[model samples]
Target: MEFNNNIPIYIQVIEKIKQEIVTGKLKPGEKMPSSRDYGNNLGINFNTVARVYKEMEMEELLFTRRGLGTFVTESEDRIGQLRYEMAKKQIENFIFNMKQIGYTKKDMIKFIETENYLEGDE
Candidate 1:
């Protein structure tokens, strides 16, 4: 709920929801809080929460039932895909940062192997 001046609030909300889903805090098929309530809890505008929910629905991460509420998607495959995508993004960011610091692919590989090999040597 803390908004960063550097990033769009709606995007931050979307990420929070995705993290909850990936962490099992928000289980599949669980009903999400109504936009109004969530906004109040976060001290943000209802419209912003509505935008977050709508964008998530578009991503197939959530679905809304008529006269009911939005719920997390019930597809295990979708959840797995989300996890993979998130991990891939994290790895990509790590690689980019390492490259920015003048690390080559060879250096990264060597570092990984050295650190992991010693730990597993026993």
Candidate 2:
């Protein structure tokens, strides 16, 4: 929950919530905390929490009940799509970095196949 100075706080908060949803830390149809409570918990403005919820709703990652509060989306297809979208962005970044370091597509594939990446290399 530490804020990155380089990134806007609301964007970081949005990313964190998205990650939680994608990872099942926030279950589908689970009620989200009230904006006031969430803002208090994060030490952010309530308006910021409201903005986050609004953006998420527009993205279909969340939906609000008439008076029951906001909940995570119950669509498995959307969740799967989110997972793929997140992974694809990561892979794009990895490839871009690798290319900048003089790596080829073949080299990247070979590195992946050879490295025991599943085991923590620490």
Any idea what lDDT model 1 has? 0.93
User: Per-residue lDDT for 1-122 in model 1, tens only?
Assistant: 57898999999999999999998999999999999999999999999999999999999999999899999999989988999999999999989999999999999889978778567567
Q: Residue by residue across 1-122, what tens digits does model 2's lDDT show?
A: 79999998889998999899899999999999999999999999999999999999999999999889999999999989999999999999999999999999999998987886756755
Q: Highest TM-score among the candidates is held by which one?
A: 2
With a 3 Å backbone cut-off (N, CA, C), the pairs that clash in candidate 1 are none
lDDT of 2: 0.93
Which consecutive 10 residues in model 2 have the weakest lDDT in total?
113-122
At residue 61, what lDDT does model 1 achieve? 96
| Each prediction's whole-model lDDT (CA) | 0.93, 0.93
Worst 10 residues of 1 by lDDT: 113-122
